[model samples]
Target: MQPDPSSLLQQALRELDYGQQPANLYDPIRYIMSLGGKRLRPLLTLLGGQLFTDELGPLVKPALATEVFHNFTLLHDDLMDQAPLRRGQPTVHEKWNANVAILSGDVMLVRAYELLFENVSLPLLPQVLRRFSQTAAEVCEGQQWDMNFETETTVTIPQYLDMIRLKTAVLLGFALELGATLAGASATDAEHLRQFGTDIGLAFQLRDDLLDVYGDAATFGKRVGGDIISDKKTFLLLTALAQATAAQQATLAQYLGQPILDAEAKVQAVRAIYDELHIRPQTEALINEYFQAALQHLERVAAPAARKQPLHHLALQLMDREN
Candidate 1:
Protein backbone atom coordinates (compact mmCIF):
# COMPACT_ATOMS: atom_id res chain seq x y z
CA MET A 1 0.00 0.00 0.00
CA GLN A 2 1.11 3.53 -0.67
CA PRO A 3 2.03 5.84 2.21
CA ASP A 4 -0.58 8.50 2.77
CA PRO A 5 0.11 12.20 2.24
CA SER A 6 0.14 12.73 6.04
CA SER A 7 2.72 9.97 6.50
CA LEU A 8 4.90 11.50 3.81
CA LEU A 9 4.66 14.94 5.39
CA GLN A 10 5.43 13.56 8.85
CA GLN A 11 8.50 11.68 7.61
CA ALA A 12 9.76 14.81 5.90
CA LEU A 13 9.25 16.79 9.10
CA ARG A 14 11.21 14.21 11.10
CA GLU A 15 14.12 14.36 8.66
CA LEU A 16 14.12 18.17 8.52
CA ASP A 17 17.41 19.83 9.45
CA TYR A 18 17.30 23.31 10.95
CA GLY A 19 21.00 23.58 11.71
CA GLN A 20 22.75 22.46 14.97
CA GLN A 21 25.01 25.30 16.06
CA PRO A 22 22.33 27.48 17.64
CA ALA A 23 20.74 24.82 19.86
CA ASN A 24 18.52 27.28 21.66
CA LEU A 25 17.11 28.79 18.46
CA TYR A 26 16.72 25.55 16.54
CA ASP A 27 15.64 23.35 19.45
CA PRO A 28 12.51 25.34 20.09
CA ILE A 29 11.53 25.08 16.46
CA ARG A 30 11.99 21.33 16.60
CA TYR A 31 10.19 21.10 19.93
CA ILE A 32 7.12 22.98 18.74
CA MET A 33 6.97 21.09 15.48
CA SER A 34 7.21 17.79 17.32
CA LEU A 35 4.43 18.80 19.64
CA GLY A 36 1.96 18.34 16.86
CA GLY A 37 -1.58 19.11 15.87
CA LYS A 38 -3.45 18.07 12.71
CA ARG A 39 -0.85 19.55 10.27
CA LEU A 40 -3.91 20.40 8.22
CA ARG A 41 -2.45 23.25 6.16
CA PRO A 42 0.45 21.34 4.67
CA LEU A 43 -1.69 18.29 4.05
CA LEU A 44 -4.02 20.47 2.03
CA THR A 45 -1.06 21.57 -0.05
CA LEU A 46 -0.20 17.97 -0.87
CA LEU A 47 -3.84 17.17 -1.62
CA GLY A 48 -4.20 20.21 -3.87
CA GLY A 49 -1.17 19.18 -5.88
CA GLN A 50 -2.38 15.58 -6.04
CA LEU A 51 -5.55 16.81 -7.66
CA PHE A 52 -3.46 17.81 -10.65
CA THR A 53 -0.79 15.07 -10.64
CA ASP A 54 0.12 11.78 -8.98
CA GLU A 55 3.72 12.85 -8.32
CA LEU A 56 3.80 14.26 -4.75
CA GLY A 57 7.60 14.46 -4.39
CA PRO A 58 7.80 18.03 -5.67
CA LEU A 59 5.02 19.08 -3.32
CA VAL A 60 6.62 17.83 -0.07
CA LYS A 61 9.14 20.60 0.61
CA PRO A 62 6.73 23.33 -0.40
CA ALA A 63 3.99 21.70 1.64
CA LEU A 64 6.39 21.58 4.55
CA ALA A 65 6.79 25.31 4.15
CA THR A 66 3.13 25.79 5.00
CA GLU A 67 3.49 23.78 8.20
CA VAL A 68 6.63 25.71 9.18
CA PHE A 69 4.92 29.01 8.61
CA HIS A 70 1.89 27.82 10.56
CA ASN A 71 3.96 26.72 13.58
CA PHE A 72 5.82 30.04 13.46
CA THR A 73 2.52 31.84 13.78
CA LEU A 74 1.48 29.58 16.68
CA LEU A 75 4.76 30.18 18.48
CA HIS A 76 4.27 33.95 18.40
CA ASP A 77 0.55 33.71 18.97
CA ASP A 78 1.13 31.65 22.12
CA LEU A 79 3.50 34.34 23.37
CA MET A 80 1.11 37.17 22.51
CA ASP A 81 -1.87 35.41 24.06
CA GLN A 82 0.21 34.28 27.06
CA ALA A 83 -1.06 30.82 26.39
CA PRO A 84 0.51 28.28 28.72
CA LEU A 85 -0.08 25.29 26.51
CA ARG A 86 -0.24 24.17 22.90
CA ARG A 87 -1.35 20.66 21.91
CA GLY A 88 -1.45 20.15 25.70
CA GLN A 89 2.28 20.76 26.15
CA PRO A 90 3.94 23.82 27.62
CA THR A 91 4.05 26.48 24.93
CA VAL A 92 7.40 27.66 23.62
CA HIS A 93 7.14 30.87 25.63
CA GLU A 94 6.39 28.88 28.77
CA LYS A 95 9.05 26.19 28.23
CA TRP A 96 11.67 28.70 27.26
CA ASN A 97 11.08 32.44 27.60
CA ALA A 98 9.11 35.02 25.64
CA ASN A 99 12.29 36.30 23.97
CA VAL A 100 13.30 32.81 22.90
CA ALA A 101 9.84 32.11 21.51
CA ILE A 102 9.83 35.42 19.62
CA LEU A 103 13.28 34.98 18.06
CA SER A 104 12.67 31.32 17.22
CA GLY A 105 9.37 32.19 15.60
CA ASP A 106 11.17 34.81 13.50
CA VAL A 107 13.66 32.19 12.36
CA MET A 108 10.86 29.79 11.43
CA LEU A 109 9.31 32.47 9.21
CA VAL A 110 12.62 32.95 7.37
CA ARG A 111 13.10 29.20 7.12
CA ALA A 112 9.63 28.81 5.59
CA TYR A 113 10.64 31.20 2.84
CA GLU A 114 13.91 29.37 2.41
CA LEU A 115 12.07 26.08 1.96
CA LEU A 116 9.79 27.61 -0.67
CA PHE A 117 12.67 29.27 -2.54
CA GLU A 118 14.71 26.09 -2.53
CA ASN A 119 11.90 23.81 -3.64
CA VAL A 120 9.61 25.73 -6.00
CA SER A 121 10.48 25.96 -9.72
CA LEU A 122 11.97 29.24 -10.97
CA PRO A 123 9.08 29.81 -13.34
CA LEU A 124 6.56 29.70 -10.46
CA LEU A 125 8.80 31.17 -7.73
CA PRO A 126 7.89 34.82 -8.21
CA GLN A 127 4.17 34.19 -8.28
CA VAL A 128 4.29 31.83 -5.31
CA LEU A 129 6.41 34.24 -3.28
CA ARG A 130 4.07 37.11 -4.08
CA ARG A 131 1.04 35.20 -2.87
CA PHE A 132 2.89 33.90 0.21
CA SER A 133 4.07 37.41 1.13
CA GLN A 134 0.59 38.86 0.76
CA THR A 135 -0.85 36.00 2.83
CA ALA A 136 1.73 36.57 5.57
CA ALA A 137 0.95 40.28 5.76
CA GLU A 138 -2.78 39.59 5.77
CA VAL A 139 -2.29 37.17 8.65
CA CYS A 140 -0.58 39.92 10.64
CA GLU A 141 -3.36 42.32 9.76
CA GLY A 142 -5.92 39.78 10.95
CA GLN A 143 -4.09 39.30 14.24
CA GLN A 144 -4.02 43.06 14.74
CA TRP A 145 -7.73 43.31 14.06
CA ASP A 146 -8.40 40.47 16.55
CA MET A 147 -6.43 42.27 19.29
CA ASN A 148 -8.20 45.51 18.46
CA PHE A 149 -11.60 43.81 18.64
CA GLU A 150 -10.89 42.78 22.23
CA THR A 151 -10.70 46.44 23.29
CA GLU A 152 -13.26 47.89 20.92
CA THR A 153 -16.82 47.82 22.28
CA THR A 154 -18.53 47.39 18.90
CA VAL A 155 -17.45 44.61 16.54
CA THR A 156 -19.84 43.56 13.80
CA ILE A 157 -20.15 39.99 12.52
CA PRO A 158 -18.91 41.04 9.09
CA GLN A 159 -15.82 42.60 10.66
CA TYR A 160 -15.22 39.50 12.70
CA LEU A 161 -15.67 37.25 9.62
CA ASP A 162 -13.19 39.30 7.62
CA MET A 163 -10.69 39.18 10.46
CA ILE A 164 -10.80 35.36 10.58
CA ARG A 165 -10.59 35.31 6.79
CA LEU A 166 -7.30 37.18 6.87
CA LYS A 167 -5.78 35.67 10.00
CA THR A 168 -6.77 32.04 9.51
CA ALA A 169 -8.43 31.38 6.16
CA VAL A 170 -6.01 33.10 3.73
CA LEU A 171 -3.08 30.92 4.73
CA LEU A 172 -5.23 27.85 4.07
CA GLY A 173 -6.15 29.37 0.72
CA PHE A 174 -2.51 29.95 -0.14
CA ALA A 175 -1.57 26.40 0.84
CA LEU A 176 -4.04 24.94 -1.67
CA GLU A 177 -3.23 27.53 -4.30
CA LEU A 178 0.49 26.88 -3.89
CA GLY A 179 0.05 23.16 -4.37
CA ALA A 180 -2.32 23.53 -7.32
CA THR A 181 -0.14 26.13 -9.02
CA LEU A 182 3.06 24.14 -8.53
CA ALA A 183 1.37 21.02 -9.91
CA GLY A 184 0.48 22.88 -13.15
CA ALA A 185 -3.23 23.28 -12.42
CA SER A 186 -4.86 25.89 -14.61
CA ALA A 187 -5.38 29.36 -13.16
CA THR A 188 -9.13 28.89 -12.90
CA ASP A 189 -8.86 25.55 -11.12
CA ALA A 190 -6.25 26.94 -8.71
CA GLU A 191 -8.51 29.85 -7.77
CA HIS A 192 -11.38 27.48 -7.17
CA LEU A 193 -9.12 25.34 -4.99
CA ARG A 194 -8.07 28.47 -3.09
CA GLN A 195 -11.69 29.41 -2.53
CA PHE A 196 -12.43 25.88 -1.42
CA GLY A 197 -9.66 26.12 1.16
CA THR A 198 -10.79 29.54 2.34
CA ASP A 199 -14.33 28.37 2.92
CA ILE A 200 -13.16 25.27 4.79
CA GLY A 201 -10.79 27.38 6.86
CA LEU A 202 -13.64 29.64 7.94
CA ALA A 203 -15.72 26.67 9.01
CA PHE A 204 -12.74 25.11 10.77
CA GLN A 205 -12.21 28.13 13.00
CA LEU A 206 -15.88 28.45 13.82
CA ARG A 207 -16.01 24.76 14.73
CA ASP A 208 -13.09 25.41 17.09
CA ASP A 209 -15.13 28.06 18.85
CA LEU A 210 -18.05 25.65 19.11
CA LEU A 211 -15.96 22.81 20.46
CA ASP A 212 -14.26 24.97 23.10
CA VAL A 213 -17.57 25.14 24.93
CA TYR A 214 -19.30 21.99 23.80
CA GLY A 215 -16.58 19.38 23.39
CA ASP A 216 -15.92 16.68 25.95
CA ALA A 217 -12.87 17.43 28.07
CA ALA A 218 -11.24 14.03 27.55
CA THR A 219 -11.27 14.17 23.74
CA PHE A 220 -11.08 17.93 23.26
CA GLY A 221 -7.29 17.88 24.09
CA LYS A 222 -7.55 21.13 26.09
CA ARG A 223 -9.59 22.59 28.85
CA VAL A 224 -13.12 23.29 27.72
CA GLY A 225 -14.16 26.95 28.09
CA GLY A 226 -10.63 28.33 28.01
CA ASP A 227 -11.95 30.74 25.41
CA ILE A 228 -14.68 31.88 27.74
CA ILE A 229 -12.26 32.32 30.62
CA SER A 230 -10.04 34.47 28.44
CA ASP A 231 -12.99 36.33 26.93
CA LYS A 232 -11.59 35.87 23.46
CA LYS A 233 -14.02 37.45 21.00
CA THR A 234 -15.08 34.27 19.23
CA PHE A 235 -18.14 33.95 17.02
CA LEU A 236 -20.11 32.31 19.81
CA LEU A 237 -19.45 35.17 22.22
CA LEU A 238 -20.01 37.83 19.57
CA THR A 239 -23.24 36.27 18.33
CA ALA A 240 -24.58 35.78 21.83
CA LEU A 241 -23.77 39.41 22.51
CA ALA A 242 -25.66 40.48 19.43
CA GLN A 243 -28.74 38.36 20.16
CA ALA A 244 -28.87 38.84 23.92
CA THR A 245 -31.63 40.91 25.49
CA ALA A 246 -31.00 43.85 27.83
CA ALA A 247 -31.07 41.51 30.83
CA GLN A 248 -28.95 38.87 29.12
CA GLN A 249 -26.48 41.56 28.05
CA ALA A 250 -26.11 42.73 31.63
CA THR A 251 -25.43 39.15 32.74
CA LEU A 252 -22.79 38.72 30.05
CA ALA A 253 -21.16 42.02 30.99
CA GLN A 254 -21.13 41.14 34.65
CA TYR A 255 -19.38 37.87 33.99
CA LEU A 256 -16.99 39.16 31.35
CA GLY A 257 -16.20 42.33 33.27
CA GLN A 258 -15.06 40.52 36.37
CA PRO A 259 -11.28 40.84 36.72
CA ILE A 260 -11.06 37.81 38.99
CA LEU A 261 -13.42 34.88 39.55
CA ASP A 262 -13.49 31.13 39.81
CA ALA A 263 -12.51 29.84 36.35
CA GLU A 264 -15.08 27.06 36.20
CA ALA A 265 -17.74 29.40 37.54
CA LYS A 266 -17.04 31.87 34.79
CA VAL A 267 -17.19 29.15 32.17
CA GLN A 268 -20.46 27.88 33.56
CA ALA A 269 -22.00 31.34 33.81
CA VAL A 270 -20.97 32.31 30.29
CA ARG A 271 -21.95 28.94 28.91
CA ALA A 272 -25.38 29.39 30.41
CA ILE A 273 -25.77 32.59 28.43
CA TYR A 274 -24.66 30.82 25.27
CA ASP A 275 -27.18 28.08 25.94
CA GLU A 276 -30.03 30.55 26.53
CA LEU A 277 -29.32 32.23 23.22
CA HIS A 278 -29.10 28.89 21.37
CA ILE A 279 -25.64 29.96 20.21
CA ARG A 280 -24.47 26.39 19.56
CA PRO A 281 -27.11 25.71 16.90
CA GLN A 282 -26.51 29.10 15.33
CA THR A 283 -22.77 28.53 15.17
CA GLU A 284 -23.30 25.05 13.72
CA ALA A 285 -25.66 26.52 11.14
CA LEU A 286 -23.04 28.99 9.98
CA ILE A 287 -20.37 26.28 9.94
CA ASN A 288 -22.62 24.23 7.72
CA GLU A 289 -23.08 27.24 5.45
CA TYR A 290 -19.35 27.69 4.95
CA PHE A 291 -18.81 23.94 4.67
CA GLN A 292 -21.43 23.63 1.98
CA ALA A 293 -19.86 26.60 0.22
CA ALA A 294 -16.49 24.83 0.33
CA LEU A 295 -18.02 21.74 -1.31
CA GLN A 296 -19.53 23.92 -4.02
CA HIS A 297 -16.12 25.36 -4.83
CA LEU A 298 -14.60 21.89 -4.73
CA GLU A 299 -17.22 20.81 -7.24
CA ARG A 300 -16.24 23.72 -9.47
CA VAL A 301 -12.64 22.52 -9.71
CA ALA A 302 -12.15 20.90 -13.12
CA ALA A 303 -10.50 17.73 -11.85
CA PRO A 304 -12.06 14.36 -12.53
CA ALA A 305 -14.38 13.23 -9.70
CA ALA A 306 -12.21 10.18 -9.03
CA ARG A 307 -9.14 12.41 -8.62
CA LYS A 308 -10.99 14.64 -6.17
CA GLN A 309 -12.02 11.86 -3.75
CA PRO A 310 -9.12 12.18 -1.33
CA LEU A 311 -9.64 15.91 -0.84
CA HIS A 312 -13.39 15.47 -0.55
CA HIS A 313 -12.99 12.78 2.10
CA LEU A 314 -10.40 14.86 3.95
CA ALA A 315 -12.74 17.85 4.08
CA LEU A 316 -15.49 15.64 5.50
CA GLN A 317 -13.10 14.27 8.13
CA LEU A 318 -12.06 17.79 9.11
CA MET A 319 -15.67 18.79 9.64
CA ASP A 320 -16.27 15.73 11.79
CA ARG A 321 -13.30 16.20 14.13
CA GLU A 322 -14.11 16.61 17.84
CA ASN A 323 -10.78 18.11 18.76
Candidate 2:
Protein backbone atom coordinates (compact mmCIF):
# COMPACT_ATOMS: atom_id res chain seq x y z
CA MET A 1 0.00 0.00 0.00
CA GLN A 2 1.02 3.60 -0.56
CA PRO A 3 2.02 5.67 2.47
CA ASP A 4 -0.50 8.09 3.90
CA PRO A 5 0.57 11.69 3.30
CA SER A 6 -0.49 13.06 6.68
CA SER A 7 1.25 10.49 8.87
CA LEU A 8 4.29 10.23 6.62
CA LEU A 9 4.65 13.99 6.54
CA GLN A 10 4.45 14.14 10.32
CA GLN A 11 7.16 11.52 10.66
CA ALA A 12 9.37 13.48 8.26
CA LEU A 13 8.83 16.67 10.28
CA ARG A 14 9.81 14.90 13.45
CA GLU A 15 12.87 13.42 11.79
CA LEU A 16 13.88 16.88 10.61
CA ASP A 17 13.86 18.14 14.20
CA TYR A 18 16.08 15.49 15.74
CA GLY A 19 19.59 16.55 16.88
CA GLN A 20 19.21 20.23 16.06
CA GLN A 21 19.64 23.37 18.19
CA PRO A 22 20.65 27.06 18.00
CA ALA A 23 17.24 28.64 17.73
CA ASN A 24 18.33 30.95 14.92
CA LEU A 25 19.22 28.16 12.54
CA TYR A 26 17.00 25.47 14.00
CA ASP A 27 13.98 27.74 14.14
CA PRO A 28 14.08 28.47 10.43
CA ILE A 29 14.85 24.82 9.70
CA ARG A 30 11.93 23.72 11.80
CA TYR A 31 9.62 26.26 10.22
CA ILE A 32 10.56 25.26 6.69
CA MET A 33 10.44 21.51 7.42
CA SER A 34 7.07 21.87 9.05
CA LEU A 35 5.67 23.98 6.24
CA GLY A 36 5.01 20.79 4.28
CA GLY A 37 5.96 19.59 0.84
CA LYS A 38 5.43 16.24 -0.87
CA ARG A 39 8.56 14.87 0.93
CA LEU A 40 9.09 12.94 -2.32
CA ARG A 41 12.90 12.96 -2.18
CA PRO A 42 13.16 11.42 1.30
CA LEU A 43 10.38 8.98 0.54
CA LEU A 44 12.22 7.87 -2.59
CA THR A 45 15.42 7.45 -0.58
CA LEU A 46 13.63 5.27 1.96
CA LEU A 47 12.05 3.22 -0.80
CA GLY A 48 15.37 2.88 -2.59
CA GLY A 49 17.00 1.66 0.63
CA GLN A 50 14.20 -0.88 1.02
CA LEU A 51 15.00 -2.44 -2.34
CA PHE A 52 17.93 -4.15 -0.60
CA THR A 53 16.07 -5.04 2.60
CA ASP A 54 12.73 -4.56 4.37
CA GLU A 55 14.17 -2.98 7.50
CA LEU A 56 13.96 0.85 7.68
CA GLY A 57 15.80 1.74 10.91
CA PRO A 58 19.31 2.17 9.55
CA LEU A 59 17.94 3.92 6.43
CA VAL A 60 16.33 6.89 8.19
CA LYS A 61 19.50 8.96 8.59
CA PRO A 62 20.46 8.80 4.94
CA ALA A 63 16.84 9.26 3.93
CA LEU A 64 16.74 12.34 6.09
CA ALA A 65 19.91 13.51 4.38
CA THR A 66 18.01 13.47 1.11
CA GLU A 67 15.44 15.83 2.60
CA VAL A 68 18.11 18.11 4.03
CA PHE A 69 19.70 18.37 0.63
CA HIS A 70 16.31 19.05 -0.91
CA ASN A 71 15.55 21.87 1.52
CA PHE A 72 19.02 23.29 1.03
CA THR A 73 18.19 23.63 -2.65
CA LEU A 74 14.83 25.18 -1.93
CA LEU A 75 16.38 27.71 0.42
CA HIS A 76 18.83 28.89 -2.18
CA ASP A 77 16.29 28.57 -4.97
CA ASP A 78 13.88 30.88 -3.22
CA LEU A 79 16.65 33.43 -2.91
CA MET A 80 17.60 33.06 -6.54
CA ASP A 81 14.01 33.05 -7.78
CA GLN A 82 13.16 36.00 -5.53
CA ALA A 83 10.20 33.93 -4.46
CA PRO A 84 8.25 35.54 -1.64
CA LEU A 85 6.52 32.46 -0.37
CA ARG A 86 7.03 28.74 0.16
CA ARG A 87 4.36 26.26 1.17
CA GLY A 88 2.00 29.24 1.51
CA GLN A 89 4.29 30.91 4.02
CA PRO A 90 7.07 33.48 3.80
CA THR A 91 10.30 32.21 2.33
CA VAL A 92 13.46 32.38 4.38
CA HIS A 93 14.77 35.34 2.47
CA GLU A 94 11.45 37.09 2.66
CA LYS A 95 10.82 36.39 6.31
CA TRP A 96 14.32 37.19 7.35
CA ASN A 97 16.88 38.67 4.91
CA ALA A 98 18.93 37.53 1.93
CA ASN A 99 22.20 37.29 3.85
CA VAL A 100 20.58 35.33 6.63
CA ALA A 101 18.90 33.06 4.11
CA ILE A 102 22.20 32.45 2.35
CA LEU A 103 24.02 31.64 5.59
CA SER A 104 21.20 29.44 6.82
CA GLY A 105 21.24 27.61 3.51
CA ASP A 106 24.98 27.03 3.84
CA VAL A 107 24.41 25.59 7.30
CA MET A 108 21.74 23.28 5.92
CA LEU A 109 24.18 22.02 3.30
CA VAL A 110 26.69 21.33 6.07
CA ARG A 111 24.01 19.59 8.10
CA ALA A 112 23.24 17.36 5.12
CA TYR A 113 26.84 16.24 5.16
CA GLU A 114 26.77 15.80 8.92
CA LEU A 115 23.90 13.33 8.62
CA LEU A 116 25.21 11.65 5.45
CA PHE A 117 28.89 11.31 6.36
CA GLU A 118 28.44 10.26 9.99
CA ASN A 119 27.34 6.65 9.51
CA VAL A 120 28.79 6.08 6.02
CA SER A 121 31.45 3.38 5.92
CA LEU A 122 34.93 4.84 5.40
CA PRO A 123 35.62 2.79 2.24
CA LEU A 124 32.33 3.91 0.68
CA LEU A 125 32.34 7.49 1.97
CA PRO A 126 34.52 8.82 -0.81
CA GLN A 127 32.20 7.50 -3.53
CA VAL A 128 29.12 8.70 -1.68
CA LEU A 129 30.56 12.16 -1.23
CA ARG A 130 31.60 12.28 -4.85
CA ARG A 131 28.11 11.39 -6.01
CA PHE A 132 26.56 13.97 -3.70
CA SER A 133 28.94 16.68 -4.91
CA GLN A 134 28.27 15.88 -8.56
CA THR A 135 24.53 15.91 -7.99
CA ALA A 136 24.73 19.27 -6.19
CA ALA A 137 26.78 20.89 -8.94
CA GLU A 138 24.48 19.53 -11.63
CA VAL A 139 21.48 20.95 -9.83
CA CYS A 140 23.18 24.34 -9.75
CA GLU A 141 24.02 24.05 -13.43
CA GLY A 142 20.39 23.25 -14.14
CA GLN A 143 19.24 26.29 -12.18
CA GLN A 144 21.64 28.54 -14.09
CA TRP A 145 20.28 27.13 -17.34
CA ASP A 146 16.75 27.78 -16.14
CA MET A 147 17.59 31.39 -15.35
CA ASN A 148 19.21 31.74 -18.77
CA PHE A 149 16.04 30.44 -20.38
CA GLU A 150 14.15 33.45 -19.03
CA THR A 151 15.95 35.77 -21.50
CA GLU A 152 16.21 33.41 -24.48
CA THR A 153 13.29 33.41 -26.86
CA THR A 154 14.01 30.20 -28.71
CA VAL A 155 14.58 27.30 -26.36
CA THR A 156 13.86 24.02 -28.14
CA ILE A 157 11.61 21.42 -26.56
CA PRO A 158 14.51 19.00 -26.24
CA GLN A 159 16.64 21.66 -24.59
CA TYR A 160 13.85 22.47 -22.15
CA LEU A 161 13.46 18.79 -21.29
CA ASP A 162 17.18 18.46 -20.67
CA MET A 163 17.11 21.53 -18.46
CA ILE A 164 14.30 20.19 -16.29
CA ARG A 165 15.96 16.78 -16.17
CA LEU A 166 19.07 18.33 -14.68
CA LYS A 167 17.33 20.87 -12.45
CA THR A 168 14.46 18.85 -11.03
CA ALA A 169 14.84 15.20 -12.00
CA VAL A 170 18.51 14.42 -11.29
CA LEU A 171 18.08 15.08 -7.59
CA LEU A 172 15.25 12.58 -7.47
CA GLY A 173 17.52 10.16 -9.31
CA PHE A 174 20.27 10.83 -6.81
CA ALA A 175 17.95 10.27 -3.87
CA LEU A 176 17.00 6.81 -5.09
CA GLU A 177 20.51 5.80 -6.11
CA LEU A 178 22.01 7.04 -2.86
CA GLY A 179 19.59 4.97 -0.84
CA ALA A 180 20.28 1.90 -2.96
CA THR A 181 24.01 2.37 -2.48
CA LEU A 182 23.64 2.80 1.31
CA ALA A 183 21.78 -0.48 1.41
CA GLY A 184 24.68 -2.20 -0.44
CA ALA A 185 22.74 -2.97 -3.60
CA SER A 186 24.79 -4.01 -6.60
CA ALA A 187 25.95 -1.10 -8.77
CA THR A 188 23.80 -2.32 -11.64
CA ASP A 189 20.70 -2.30 -9.48
CA ALA A 190 21.54 1.18 -8.20
CA GLU A 191 22.05 2.39 -11.75
CA HIS A 192 18.65 1.02 -12.74
CA LEU A 193 17.05 2.69 -9.75
CA ARG A 194 18.63 5.99 -10.78
CA GLN A 195 17.33 5.60 -14.32
CA PHE A 196 13.86 4.89 -12.99
CA GLY A 197 13.98 8.09 -10.92
CA THR A 198 15.25 10.21 -13.83
CA ASP A 199 12.45 9.08 -16.09
CA ILE A 200 9.82 9.62 -13.40
CA GLY A 201 11.27 13.03 -12.62
CA LEU A 202 10.91 14.05 -16.25
CA ALA A 203 7.31 12.82 -16.27
CA PHE A 204 6.58 14.56 -12.98
CA GLN A 205 7.83 17.87 -14.36
CA LEU A 206 5.77 17.50 -17.54
CA ARG A 207 2.69 16.75 -15.46
CA ASP A 208 3.41 19.88 -13.43
CA ASP A 209 3.41 21.89 -16.65
CA LEU A 210 0.01 20.42 -17.52
CA LEU A 211 -1.34 21.06 -14.04
CA ASP A 212 -0.27 24.71 -14.00
CA VAL A 213 -2.86 25.48 -16.63
CA TYR A 214 -5.47 22.78 -16.00
CA GLY A 215 -5.48 21.77 -12.33
CA ASP A 216 -8.22 22.56 -9.85
CA ALA A 217 -7.53 25.79 -8.01
CA ALA A 218 -8.07 24.45 -4.51
CA THR A 219 -5.78 21.47 -4.84
CA PHE A 220 -3.01 23.22 -6.73
CA GLY A 221 -1.95 25.36 -3.69
CA LYS A 222 -0.71 28.36 -5.67
CA ARG A 223 -2.60 30.09 -8.43
CA VAL A 224 -3.62 27.69 -11.21
CA GLY A 225 -2.52 29.93 -14.09
CA GLY A 226 0.77 31.36 -12.75
CA ASP A 227 2.75 29.74 -15.54
CA ILE A 228 0.65 31.35 -18.22
CA ILE A 229 0.82 34.69 -16.40
CA SER A 230 4.59 34.49 -16.19
CA ASP A 231 4.75 33.39 -19.84
CA LYS A 232 7.07 30.53 -18.94
CA LYS A 233 8.59 28.45 -21.74
CA THR A 234 6.93 25.22 -20.76
CA PHE A 235 6.48 22.19 -23.03
CA LEU A 236 2.96 23.25 -23.92
CA LEU A 237 4.11 26.74 -24.88
CA LEU A 238 7.07 25.46 -26.84
CA THR A 239 4.92 22.93 -28.67
CA ALA A 240 2.33 25.60 -29.31
CA LEU A 241 5.02 27.83 -30.73
CA ALA A 242 6.10 25.05 -33.06
CA GLN A 243 2.55 24.33 -34.18
CA ALA A 244 0.97 27.81 -34.38
CA THR A 245 -0.15 29.36 -37.62
CA ALA A 246 1.50 32.59 -38.78
CA ALA A 247 -1.26 34.83 -37.37
CA GLN A 248 -1.36 32.91 -34.11
CA GLN A 249 2.41 33.01 -33.86
CA ALA A 250 2.43 36.74 -34.40
CA THR A 251 -0.24 37.18 -31.75
CA LEU A 252 1.78 35.21 -29.24
CA ALA A 253 5.00 37.06 -30.09
CA GLN A 254 3.34 40.40 -29.37
CA TYR A 255 2.44 39.46 -25.81
CA LEU A 256 5.51 37.47 -24.82
CA GLY A 257 8.10 40.24 -24.45
CA GLN A 258 5.87 43.19 -23.84
CA PRO A 259 5.66 44.81 -20.39
CA ILE A 260 2.41 46.76 -20.93
CA LEU A 261 0.20 43.79 -21.75
CA ASP A 262 -2.71 42.64 -19.59
CA ALA A 263 -1.69 39.44 -17.81
CA GLU A 264 -5.09 37.79 -17.62
CA ALA A 265 -6.06 38.52 -21.23
CA LYS A 266 -2.76 37.22 -22.49
CA VAL A 267 -3.26 34.10 -20.42
CA GLN A 268 -6.77 33.63 -21.81
CA ALA A 269 -5.78 34.39 -25.39
CA VAL A 270 -2.80 32.04 -25.29
CA ARG A 271 -4.89 29.41 -23.58
CA ALA A 272 -7.57 29.75 -26.28
CA ILE A 273 -4.95 29.17 -28.92
CA TYR A 274 -3.56 26.25 -26.91
CA ASP A 275 -7.06 24.76 -26.74
CA GLU A 276 -7.51 25.28 -30.48
CA LEU A 277 -4.24 23.41 -31.03
CA HIS A 278 -5.17 20.58 -28.62
CA ILE A 279 -2.07 21.28 -26.54
CA ARG A 280 -3.44 19.90 -23.28
CA PRO A 281 -3.98 16.39 -24.61
CA GLN A 282 -0.66 16.50 -26.39
CA THR A 283 1.13 17.41 -23.16
CA GLU A 284 -0.76 14.71 -21.24
CA ALA A 285 0.27 12.11 -23.83
CA LEU A 286 3.90 13.18 -23.48
CA ILE A 287 3.68 12.90 -19.70
CA ASN A 288 2.23 9.40 -19.95
CA GLU A 289 4.96 8.35 -22.35
CA TYR A 290 7.68 9.35 -19.88
CA PHE A 291 5.80 7.70 -16.99
CA GLN A 292 5.58 4.43 -18.90
CA ALA A 293 9.26 4.70 -19.77
CA ALA A 294 10.00 5.11 -16.05
CA LEU A 295 8.13 1.90 -15.28
CA GLN A 296 10.05 0.12 -17.98
CA HIS A 297 13.34 1.11 -16.36
CA LEU A 298 12.05 -0.01 -12.97
CA GLU A 299 11.17 -3.41 -14.43
CA ARG A 300 14.77 -3.88 -15.56
CA VAL A 301 15.82 -4.17 -11.91
CA ALA A 302 16.19 -7.78 -10.66
CA ALA A 303 14.56 -7.09 -7.31
CA PRO A 304 11.32 -8.83 -6.33
CA ALA A 305 8.04 -7.14 -7.15
CA ALA A 306 7.18 -6.82 -3.45
CA ARG A 307 10.35 -4.86 -2.82
CA LYS A 308 9.51 -2.32 -5.48
CA GLN A 309 5.72 -2.38 -5.26
CA PRO A 310 5.37 0.47 -2.76
CA LEU A 311 7.45 2.79 -4.92
CA HIS A 312 5.49 1.77 -8.00
CA HIS A 313 2.26 2.61 -6.22
CA LEU A 314 3.68 5.91 -5.01
CA ALA A 315 4.61 6.89 -8.55
CA LEU A 316 1.09 6.18 -9.74
CA GLN A 317 -0.36 8.24 -6.92
CA LEU A 318 1.91 11.19 -7.73
CA MET A 319 0.91 11.03 -11.38
CA ASP A 320 -2.79 10.93 -10.49
CA ARG A 321 -2.69 13.61 -7.78
CA GLU A 322 -5.12 16.50 -8.35
CA ASN A 323 -2.65 18.79 -6.59
lDDT tens readout by residue for model 2, 106-145? 8888888887888577877999889888988988888998
Q: Please, what is the whole-model Cα lDDT of each candidate in the order they appear? A: 0.91, 0.83
lDDT of 1 by residue, 182-285 (tens): 99999999999999999999999899888999988887776799889988889999999999999999988888857946888889988999999999999999
For each candidate in turn, the TM-score is 0.95, 0.92
Report the number of the highest-lDDT candidate. Answer: 1
Model 2, 9: alpha-carbon shift in Å?
8.0
For candidate 2, report its TM-score. 0.92
lDDT (0-100) at residue 147 of candidate 1? 89
Clash count of each predicted structure: 0, 0
